[model samples]
Target: MKWFFKIVVLSILLQSFQCTDTDDNSGAIISAQLETKKQEIQNYINSFSCSESVGCGFIAFGSKPCGGPRSYLLFSNSVDLTKLQAMVKTYNDMDELYNVQTNAVSDCMFVAPPTEVKCMNGICTIIK
Candidate 1:
């Protein structure tokens, strides 16, 4: 009888733990968010025109348009404005500043302490 009670108690404890919601530790949710961000940046880069010398940069795009023509600050380093302008002209892309703003940051890190960015369509706005 004692062994039966012990088993029952252990089962109940296990069930309770299984039902608990620990979103902070959810790997799938985090992975999906990361993937979505990656797609947004990829699309933005693909559409942007920078000469072969300009290389690439990271950005946070929003899910919707950000009003009319405006300058965007990218989270990237070693960005050449001249090259970016050249690419924009070649690709007819919008004018956006990369790593030029005072509050610039990168979204390329996948390590602990995830980054939060608001991206819509091909426009990205950093949320610091």
Candidate 2:
């Protein structure tokens, strides 16, 4: 009887550990996906030509036209405008940012944790 109890306890413990591992992996995947999306957004902003002179950035998520013209959403720790511009060069196919943003707004409806950039119709908000 004691042996049976020990076996059951060990099984429960193993199952619990497995569940925790799965959760950790899932969290990592989600974070990675978000970061990739954020970088893509930054690329779109950098590609555009802001008229006049200004020091501002934008992030957009979701499918609504709520935020200003140039707005974006990020899921990372920092919101460095210069870093965002530099990151845009890493992508081989920048056009994909449109489809990705569209899907993110219409399908995933993901929002950046820090900024208020919303995506709508495959275009992130752009401000002058």
Candidate 3:
């Protein structure tokens, strides 16, 4: 009887530990997703065109305006509206839960949470 009780307790403890491990992994996965999103925003910004006055512009570093959060989506002066629409759709599909804001500067793209769109102006430096 003693041995059996010990075995059962051990099994329960093991199960609890396993559950904690699973939760840890889920957190890590979420972090990775956010990192990937940041990288995508960086790539888009690096190619933004500052020459065009009408298109998107980058905001300087250390200055992020609020709106949820914001992401810049810059493009050339001759951005294809249809293509931009498609890209927006694709991004929305990636994470259905969080709202995505896309700002299009001249040849650049800044992507962030919807609250931070205003910061996506003339600062075209790549965020490291």
Candidate 4:
């Protein structure tokens, strides 16, 4: 009876450890998904090109743990603005959720928005 009780307790302890491991794995999975989403946004932005005539614009991207965007993205106005905005929203939402879930910390420094955006050479550039 003593041996059986010890064995049961050990099994419970092992199960608890396994549960924590699963939680850690979930956090890693979320991080990976966030990175993938970020890359997707970048790829979409890259698909469009800007020239002096094409025009360029900037949009805030990603949510910080403390609030506000992590950074801004520059893109050509020739792209599908509606689709791009939707994708950014999705990515931001996921980023916010990931921050909350992982208890992510940030410097909480204010990121200034661009003073101007223009097409420099063949690419859209943000002039700080």
Best by TM-score: 4
- TM-score list, all predictions: 0.23, 0.24, 0.32, 0.77
What Cα-based lDDT does every candidate model obtain?
0.41, 0.43, 0.42, 0.89
Q: Which model is ahead, 1 or 2, in terms of TM-score?
A: 2
Q: What digit string (tens of lDDT, one per residue) describes model 3 on residues 1-128?
A: 99999999999999887844334333222435645765664565455444435444322221122322234454443344464555444444443333232321232245442222222355433343
Which candidate ranks first by lDDT, i.e. highest? 4
Kindly give the stretch of ten consecutive residues in candidate 4 with the minimal lDDT sum: 20-29
Superposed Cα RMSD, model 3: 10.9
Local distance difference test, candidate 2: 0.43
Candidate 3 ranges with C-alpha deviation above 4 Å: 1-29, 57-75, 78-84, 98-128
Q: What's the number of clashes in each of the models?
A: 15, 21, 36, 0
Q: Sorted on lDDT, highest at the top, how do the candidates line up?
A: 4, 2, 3, 1
lDDT, candidate 1, 12-72, per-residue tens: 9998888666555432223345345445544545565443344334432321122222223
lDDT of 3 at 42: 53
The order of the candidates by TM-score, greatest first, is 4, 3, 2, 1
Give the better candidate number (1 or 4) by lDDT.
4
By TM-score, how accurate is candidate 3?
0.32
For model 2, residues 19-120, the per-residue Cα lDDT tens digits are 443343332223355468656765655465432232334433322223222223432223455665455433312323433444433333334443333333
